[model samples]
Target chain A: MSLSPLAIVLLAVTLLLGVGFYGLLVARNLIKLIVVLQILAKAAMLAFVAAGYGQEHMGLAQSMVAMVIVADTVVAVIALALAVQVRRHYGTLDVRKLTTLRG
Target chain B: MALWTSSLHPFLWLIVIPVLASPVVYLAGRLAGAALARWLALIALIVTCAPCVLAAQELAANGAATFTLGLVQLQFDGLSLLLAGLALGLGTSVTLFSNAYMRGETGEEKYYAALLAMIGVMVGLGCANDLFNLWVWFEAMAVSSYMLVAFYRDQPASLEAGVKYLVQSAAGSVLVLLGIAAVFGATGQLSLASIADSVRQAGATQATSAGLLAAGALMTVGFGVKAALVPLHTWLPDAHSQAPSGISAMLSGVVIEAGLIALLRAVSALLGEGDAVARFGQLLLLFAALNMMLGNLLALKQTQVKRMLAFSSLSHMGYMLLGFGVAAYTGQSAAAQGGMFHMLSHGLMKGLAFLAAGALLYTLYVAKGAHGPLMVNDLNGAARRYPLAALALGVAVLGLAGLPPLVGFMSKWQIFVGGFQAGDTLVALLVIFAALNSVLSLAYYAPLVNAMYRREPSHAVRLGAAMPPTMIVPLVVMSILVIALGVWPTLIAWLTEPAGQALLAGW
Candidate 1:
């Protein structure tokens, strides 16, 4: 079946979400987790843009996606900074061992 | 044309000030210490807030104002005005408190910069009428807050909290993006007003209903995490407790409210069909009820003052959710009005509570000259030691516990009445249960009050030097507002009514 643009976009989003979730759930390292999150955030923005693709005006989706990207970049920088701190303080980036508070 | 012109006037400034202020704060940080940063942030907030008040007045006079950026049209109505006001007010108070609370602390420049950036983002979020724009502002808030949370890079707990908040918030943002995509795919529109019109035009078929339900569920989950509703609220207490007290106040106060507003916008836009409305409202009620029960019950068990306040913040979000849910079902104007009032009131009360806690911690640190780690028990005779700081805490807690003649009681009364008016007896009962929870909250809140007033200071409970004017001024101002609003709720209701009406106008 020849996929519509919308279907292609949706499929790509689903795949990104799957990969991101898998990485987030399975990754042991903080940096990997941050990477997965960034991927996930980007995928969502792509989907939002795809949603507005067929519309006559694309400014709304474009503006939103642009904003999300900016936000994602900011978050990634902060997360990396925090990760660096975590490494210095705990001597490792493993999620399981960093249990100061009981969940 | 008039609607278009009026809406653009105030909202344009609302969006501009923060984008401008972000750099101003960064520049100002170089010239002065924490004091200059605080004043700069306050001035930015005041300027931002003025536009909101003007927007409220304009909306009241002109009905609803619309501003279009390209094809996306944004509305400035009573509801947006109310939220903008709350964000500005809470943002200002937190800035003031941070000046004193964070004095002598390293990284003052970076802290104030992030704080200002976050406030600006929150203002944008409040005024945003477009869903896509709203999403951007939401992400902006998440990013800035993450930096603030992890400001004390030396502390493992702070780093942990920062990491956790970022991961969770990123997940939520992704969900929101996907939901936005789904919404666009179904209706081929990005503006909330346009989407609602399209949904109505299409007539709520099974396919459309399912699409909307899926999108709504995703958006709700995403926003719910930020609002810190139960089950999805795991990251909140740690993050709130670990951040610098000023950031904590803003996180619990303004940030959560922004999330709640986003949820409100999503629900209001999509709940056009009767069946859709009913189904979504039911889901919301379920979450709200759980949030109320679990949040307060969990709070009751926390030994740390800040952690308790964080949990209580979650519980209050539950109350707002309940109000929003009721408004969804009955379309009762009052329910929507109550929801706005609850958001504003809870923001102020929680902001005050967190700031007061911060002041106490600062005082303790100063007097004792020991900074390894502090616990709630360290405040045995805090009232005697720091009378003004203790008084601030007392007033904040009393207000939070819904004591009459305090702001908290007034907001609770509005929400309860809204629940009852909507004829949601179960929710009304839950509101009553929330009331009981507030009374029970006294168990935790009263102790701090008693420790401050009644308890004699042991040798170990050292009295700190007097709190600086910067911290004391905001606390006193907030405490006075709580009492003033409590006695006269009309001050809030007048604004909230117009805000609600604006939301319902297109409906």
Candidate 2:
């Protein structure tokens, strides 16, 4: 009745993805949204490593994880910078107020 | 199958030159002058075209070019070369137009640098042969674009659009990465060719392998955001309308199409064993139909000129998707060729439309002393003052509406013909539906044209600045190509035929 290590890892990854998506759906603050994105990246990175482990290609998986980390960080940095600008210009951190460009 | 061969590894040259030189352009702006940096950026884009042309030549002679540069794999077939050439061509025009449009604007260095970087990665995306490599290039392009989209940080609209775009696009890329993970897990390979071979050898079907189907669905929705497919296209209208006009042209013209191509590549790799491709094509067609209807319907209510164009871009994406869907469904090269040609046509036509609109906006700001974005009403009798801009805009809108004398019509015709050639009842009906949608788009396009030439001068157009030659030249060039290509599409057969064949022939 015991699950394998791979199953355990995959379950964790799925849980992370679900939580991250839930945060995205509910969170309004830009910073929290960015945190959610980071959470999602963790899931993706974990999945990559687990997939590599499943295939016995740990080296490839690790290198892919490294690249994802760098790319994910760049996204965070940009998102945070934009968030700062958003707060300054709009005078609020809520995304609901960004309705200037209405259809 | 070999038609030609070249030892020159132009793919490396294509990617490395602009990417490596982008910072140099930024430095020159800081140390030398914005003018120097601007011209340098233009020169850098022009120089990058050399490798593209050489690769095109190689593709012409050899039918395809695949080579490994260090650890990264690259190729120059019809499909890759067409995309590279389109990006470079659009990049050159945008850079040239910005010289006049962005004059005296702050942060000119960062603008040019990010623009060049985006172009570089777009070229890389075209040439990428590995799935992970494609993802990296896509992320690089998306990152550079987020910077460009928020270029006017003081403007709240720009900042909002930038953040929205950043979040949606970031989420989409993460989805794509997860899909790649699932794909690698299923096939144990990352190169597209190997993945396809493995999937085929295993005879994987939707019912047989839930993992691969899940991967395909995830990638579709992931890439769909960037491609601006309906339901995932919320960020596009805002981002395209708020960014500077040159960037707007790039975003509308080539960037979204690049997303579609990336999706096409990924999906093509998954197109083996059972009804996988057919199911994917059915999904594409559903999106295509929605994109056409909703895009045109919403566009009818927009007061802003750029917003209208942005919405219209979604509809155009629909047409191109229809072509690809038909191609995928029938396993024929005809519809895909039609789709490829439509990409080329739409890239030129829409780029010209946005640029022409941009010229009018620039003049409105400079001469008429306007403070905000241009509205369609602002174009009332614009032809009397800015004749060339008005004419260019007219040609662009009409072409986009698929009038018979323009390149848009020819491409749409090709797609319809492709659909009919499929001999599938539903696909044929979809072709009819698409034709009706094309006519529906003119509901707005025609009015814009009428406002330009048929109405009394609006206050905004009464005394606008003389249209700059830098802006006029690109519109003239693109307009000419649109007409000439429509009249003689055979001229581009070398590009379109090979590209469509490459997509159908698979990795």
Candidate 3:
């Protein structure tokens, strides 16, 4: 059976979420993890806008998604700053070896 | 309808002062001096705190005060007021303590910038009635805090901790937004009040509805990470321990509680019916119980003082969660009231504890060149060296361990008594488990307390001089407040009652 437009959008969203989570779980590098997180944030934005689609007050969803993108950008800037700092401090961006503080 | 007249009258100053103060503190700190910057922080905090204290007193005496922002509404009710007061009051105390604690430290301007901005966003987080506005404030707080945590960028551990914080919380923020998206989609509403109205109209059956449960689970996990609720709590021990102790005070004191309140808002407001609440509350109680037991267990194993305090912070979050769970399960105002009181107690007591520990670290830094592990063993005869801090630490840990005649005990008493029914065996057993966890926490707390007085001083501890008076001032004030509030538990109850009632009535 052919998927409806909503179904296709949802499928795309699901694939994006899966890819993002997979990258988060499997990525060995800090930069990879940050990129994966950005992708996940993107999926969330897309999902939010899609959730608002075909409904009354679609503008609300659009506005919210725009806000989410702004927030995601803020987080990205921080993440990149942190990455530069981490690379400066640790000499590498591999998260697996970044185990300085232990319980 | 004017912007300053009605909608933002009370909170406008509370919000604007700190947000505005961040840049002012940064600029003045660099141009004038650290002394002036510190004075600015204290003054700014006082300016922000005035409205909160007045609002809290007014809320206590006259019930809730409402400030409507067009379609949005901000209520100066008990919970928001109490948490807001905790944020601002502790913001002042932390700034004062930082005056000494952060002395001669590099990047002082940037340090004050993050600290002031974090305080403003936290206060705004407390008053936000619109879900999206609340989320934005929460994210803003997180961003500012990432800077605060990693302020010592020269240190590898600080950056590591900040990186871990950002990586984890990004996912947490996404989850929170996802939950909000689901709720908006389900109800076509973004305002908390409107969402609750939609949920109430949907009735008990929606408790099991796929979309609602997803919303509940997502939001709970989202905020739970920030609140340091169990498995999601790994970032906290590192973040709190690695950050400067003054910043640690704000993190443990205000941020976690605000996270819980935001989570509670999402859960309680969006899941307004009986069945949904019961199920969600059960889940929260499970998380609460786990957080208490496991967090205390973890604390018992920590050798480092700051790290131990971090674990204990997690345990206290469990107590806060227990109170929130009660409100969730039973729609009981008593539990939320207790939770608010718990928030107040945890904020003040933990704030004091971290500052006192920072005093020891500060002394070590001053005496020697760099601070060491801050292990419990490092506190050999700290009492004789830094008497005020040691005394403050003694009182703080006692309060944290939930001893009688301390604020911790008062909050725990309210949580257990208000949440538990008289005759239910399982519930009573669970309450006992919670109480036993508090007692077990003394396993770690007692050593820290005893290390202050019972042991002979190490050469290093004896060499260090006393903490500066500015640092001591906030510690003394907080320790006294913990003791005073404990004695007059009625005072906290009165302040917190309206917060709970407002939440329940709003729901």
Candidate 4:
């Protein structure tokens, strides 16, 4: 049997979340983590739209996505800026190398 | 009366003034230099506090006041006033301390701007009446703080801590965003009051629906990370210890509590009045137990002074959560009032502790021309040279250890009384556990005190410089308030009672 549109959208959402979370868990490169965050943010955006559509407030959902997009962009920019600093200071981009603050 | 007077929309002005003026403050610093910018930042915070005080007065005269701007709603109640006052008070003090502590540090202008932006958004978060707006404010506060955490970009530890904090906190905020979306989907509403009404009207079936339950879980875990809930607090020690001393004070003092208040506000609005409140209360008590045990036990192992204080912050959060759980379970405002009071007193105690530690470190830097983390051993005979800072540190440590005649003891007593008043076996047991944890904290705290007062001067302290007036002034003021409030606990009843009622009003 073929899935309905909502089912297909939900399947996509779950798949994105699983992949994003898996990436976050396994990714060691700083840039890779940033990419993973974007993926997870995309999953959240899709969930918001699906939620809005389910509640018949597509306008509100779309507006929320817009705001999230803006906020997520800022987060990504800052994370990248921080990554550059991390690389410059430590001469590495591996997350495992970030242990100087460990007690 | 002028239509545009701050009294008319005092809470609104509290949010607007600092945010709009932050960039201006930065520009002023860039043009005129750090000194002028420092004054502007202090002035901006004080100006922001004017509206906060006005909001408190309006709240006192008229009970809770709500100001609406389209979909956004701002509420000024006892709870909002408490949070706003804590933010502005700590914000101003930290700025003052930074004037002395952050001297010779690079990027002073950006630091002031980020600090102002942080205080602005935290006030906004405290007063937000709409759930989505609350999350937005939370995100803004987190973003600004991330910058502050990474302020020393040239330092590897600072950068590492900043990146880790950013990644983890960003992940948490995304989870919160998803939870908010799920909540909106379930309720078709966004404001806390509207959502509360919708959930209450829908009855048990809709309230217990998978979607809503998932939303609740998501928000809990999301806010839990920021709140330093156990198993999710791995990032706190590093971030708190590595950041500049003033921001450390802000983080340990108010930022984490802000997360808990957001959790309480969001969850209370979503659960409305039901068995759900009690069930959530049970969950909070479980986290409370874990946080206290783990926080204090780990703190006992810390050799670094700020790191130990960081872990102590985790345990203090546990005590506050104890107050919250009892309040939620018993449906009594007294326990919640205790929680709010603990937030106030803990802010003073922890802020003092961190700032005093910072003062000692600053002295060491100035005298020895050495810089890095300050180990507990570095405090040897510190009291002789820096008597005021050491005294302030003593007050902070004893107060946090729950010694009598200090605000910490009074606040903890209120929480314990709140638990006993519940008369529930489980909550009472939890309170006892929390009490034991307070004593456990002293095992670590006493050493720092001993190192400062009893041991001979370490190399760092022998040639340390005197602390400036800007830093000393805040320390003295906070110490006086801590002792004054402890002596007359009734003085804060005005703040605590209404704050407790505000928490319960959502129900």
TM-score (C-alpha) between model 4 and the true structure: 0.97
> How many pairs collide in each candidate, listed in order?
3, 3, 2, 0
Poorly placed runs, candidate 2 (over 4 Å): B1-8, B204-208, B366-371
TM-score, per-candidate, Cα-based: 0.92, 0.97, 0.96, 0.97
2 versus 3: better TM-score goes to: 2
Q: How much is the lDDT of residue B41 in candidate 4? A: 92
Candidate 4 chain A TM-score vs. reference chain A: 0.93
Q: Mark the regions of model 3 whose C-alpha exceeds 4 Å error after superposition.
A: B1-8, B60-62, B202-208, B366-368
Q: What is the TM-score of chain A alone in each candidate?
A: 0.93, 0.95, 0.92, 0.93
Question: Please, what are the lDDT tens digits per residue for candidate 1 over residues A1-103?
Answer: 9998877987888899999989988998999999999889878887877777855446767766787787778778878878888999989999777678543
Ranking by DockQ: 2, 4, 3, 1
Tell me the DockQ of each model, to 2 decimals: 0.67, 0.84, 0.78, 0.81
Q: Which docking band does candidate 1 fall into?
A: medium
Tens digits of per-residue lDDT for model 4, B458-498? 98788778778898999999988888888888788887888
How would you encode candidate 1's per-residue C-alpha lDDT over B403-465 as one tens digit per residue?
A: 988988888888788888876677677767777877777877777677667576644356465
Model 3 chain A: worst 10 consecutive residues (lDDT sum): A49-58
Of 1 and 4, the candidate ranking higher by lDDT: 4
Clashing pairs in 3: B78-B499, B79-B499
Native-referenced DockQ of model 3: 0.78
Worst 10-residue stretch by lDDT in candidate 3 chain B?
A: B201-210
| Candidate 2 structure quality by residue, lDDT tens digits, B1-507 | 232343557766777888988999999999998999999999998888888788778777777777765555787777887888888999999999999888777889889999999988998898888888999999999999998999888889999999999999999999999988888877778888888888788866564367777788889989999999999999999999989999999999999999999999987787675477888888889999999998999999998999999999999999999999988888767899999999999999999999999999999873344347789998999999999899999999999999978999999999999999999999999999999998989999999999999658998787677888999999899989989998998798888898898888772
How does the DockQ of candidate 4 come out?
A: 0.81
Model 1 clash pairs are B78-B499, B79-B499, B383-B452
> What i-RMS does each candidate reach, in Å?
1.7, 0.8, 1.1, 0.9
Residue range with the least summed lDDT across 10 consecutive positions in model 4 chain B: B1-10
